[model samples]
Target chain A: MPHDHHDHPHALLPPEPALRVKALETILCDKGLIDPAALEEIIDTYQNKIGPQNGARVVAKAWMDPDFKRALLQDATEVVRDLGYYGRQGEHMVVVENTAEQHNMVVCTLCSCYPWPLLGIPPGWYKSDAYRARAVREPRKVLAEFGVTLPPDTSVRVWDSTAEVRYLVLPMRPEGTEGWTEDQLVALVSRDSMIGTGLALAAASVIEGVEASNQSVEGTAE
Target chain B: MSRVHDMGGRFGDGAVLPEPQDGPVFATEWHARALAVTLACGSLGQWNIDTSRHARERLSPKDYSRFSYYEKWISALADLLVETGVLTLEDLEQAAERAKDQAGGSEEIQKSHPLSSRRLLPEQVAAVLAKGGPADRQEGPVARFQPGQKVRTRRLSDSALVNGGHTRLPNYAAGAVGHIERYHGNHVLPDSAAHGLGEAPEPLYAVRFAASELWAHPEHPGDQVVLDLWQSYLLPEEVA
Candidate 1:
């Protein structure tokens, strides 16, 4: 309420959710159950300190190191925690690698149970009602919406996160980047690929330059 | 039977529309605050993630379908605070009233809160994040299902559904036969843990079901949906 507004945000209507949330914060803070400073720190930690970049690093390392990849596939909790990405929602980790024969995807039918230590807070779509419903029913169609179309012969394996074990998909590394460094390959990884909606960016596709080219593949920049 | 939140294979929700992948993680400040407060309260040790999840599943279908992500979270969080004895309904109403205005009420309310000093300080954030609340328990009952074994999921009784008990079993896979893919050792069972019955750690398995068996018409016939199911929900599928 301290911030004055004449109502012009989100179709000129009141941001009731925002106001109600503020009220809830006030109540919790007044009751001494939560600290205002700690709240800010929590937001900052998720916003800047933790996110997809952590997962990108893990994936890049997995793609580069065979032993590490084996470690990740066999036991992601120990391997991922070794890289310092360990926390709630990702306490028990499982990495499913996408291969030529099988394409892996994940969804939490009951709720959005994502690997937070590596991926941070899930995006809006991951928690959408549409996604929670249809992802399991028709994952191929859902993947198509994300601009990813697998071959007819490829098996679309959809992992519904139902238990404590969280998942991170190790998307197959893009071709034509034979000797790229870990940091360079990190840029090729998008958030969706780890969740199994899209693939890693094409090595020479876009981002640094979005100029029209015949090689502009799906999941390339933007 | 299923609660409103368990929407696995059920269709008709329409197309998936995600915000741009490169966009900001959170849309608004309130959403951020909502998330932060939830984490802070969660760190208080009074409740676990399953308890918070059960709060949402118990919501009426109308509210579950209508409320936005954070709206559902905030509502559930409020009920948790009261249920855990951290605050009362009156306490929430009064604070919400104060939030409506920047007047002198907040200063007085803070002084009156008996547990005020027990707040999670900024310095503790790093340690808390590092040492998260892990659900895995080393010791539990022996494994009942092994990999490659055919198992069928048992449905929840109508009473379990009506009573609003918490369970990890989704409705879509109910009574569906699947092959055990892997054994995930023992972990805290959400069903008993959510209601303060006990952690009741049990053996878990990843059961893989063919799309054909789960859906009347799967878009991709060869596709598979794998679910991590607790042993209690599974029964040995005798060869027929």
Candidate 2:
């Protein structure tokens, strides 16, 4: 079904942006500087193949295999590549694990640099001036705003991604999911959890989050 | 030059509103195209990612804040295209005029001009994604500091006077004392790479700075911030 602008009057983006993008694309394509098909391919890869699901798979696998987790912690790029998640913004990977005494959070204060291959695109908030500025100064307050309240004893270690190396947070595996399969465990890993803004969903709450996300998906699909 | 892009330890930007967990990859069609164009041009190897970021940062602060994320990309793309001689302003103007005419015409007008160049095929996309750009230099200057070594970030009295180039070091972290957490090996220094300078690869380290060191008041005294600092940005802590 084609998206009719008239039908969805409240579309967040106006028509001007689309027109401007089309103009730029036309110019670049006309000059033999870019191939429209190539552009589409890149977009499709990020939209479909590369996303939080890939990161979730890695997290779940790490939880199930101690050796893999060790490798991931020591050298993330090689381990992630072994699982076929390696590309731009993810070439130099660093996985910071969250423990009972210390929590890990990732932020790019300079720019919105994220692990694109593993986590697809960064969310809007991650790129916002608010998160970029306050994440370093008052991470506990920022995390609390994301509904990620930590215990007073557990110190927050904010990883400011200031260089080429990309950082990913390895949230501790939730309790009571000891026997869960990798696939089931993947369902508990949300994008925010990996960013350290939120915690991994517990086994019981995973269903509710999944259902809520499904509803949001349906809403956007229309 | 203490650009707005170096936004660490600053305050009062507003609340980070949470979007739906499952949101569209792109908010609009143009955003996808903008991203594609940027990546497509990027694959040409004409410029590195650091250069592209510097192009965006070169924009005036007002223009930088006014444009949406992808708009910044498009603006930088245009500048890069012109600067690299890939496209001319006249060519873009003509194309814009043609696009305007096509928008008013029938669908056939849009289908008339087909892309002629070799498109980045699906197979090529896979290869490109697989062959990531690792900035680490195989052999370079040996690392100066080891883990657990105390260090302080070099403070530039006037950042504008520091070669007038973009730097990865945040203003907030400058002059702050920290402990070297790990040596991340040699990587291209972005301060040089962003300005068409040769890849002066240097050893980088993950430096751990206490929250109290960076801020006056403490939200959590136990908190700490770790930054990946390039070799050029650091100096050995002065002995008493």
Query: Whose DockQ is greatest here?
Result: 1
Candidate 2 residue-wise lDDT, A25-141, digit = tens: 776655565777777788888898899999999999999999999999999988999888998889899999999999999999988889998899898899888899999999888
Backbone clashes in model 1:
0
TM-score of every candidate's chain A: 0.86, 0.86
Query: Which residue window of length 10 is worst by lDDT in model 1 chain B?
Result: B155-164
Clash numbers, per candidate: 0, 0
lDDT of 1 by residue, B171-203 (tens): 889889999998989989888888888898989
Model 1 misplaced stretches (Cα beyond 4 Å) = A1-15, A206-222, B102-107, B110-114, B157-162
DockQ of each: 0.44, 0.39
What fraction of the correct interface contacts does each predicted structure contain? 0.74, 0.63
Q: Could you say which candidate leads in lDDT?
A: 1
TM-score of each: 0.91, 0.89
Q: Model 2 chain A, poorest ten-residue lDDT window?
A: A5-14
> Model 2: residues >4 Å from true position, as ranges?
A1-16, A207-222, B102-122, B157-162
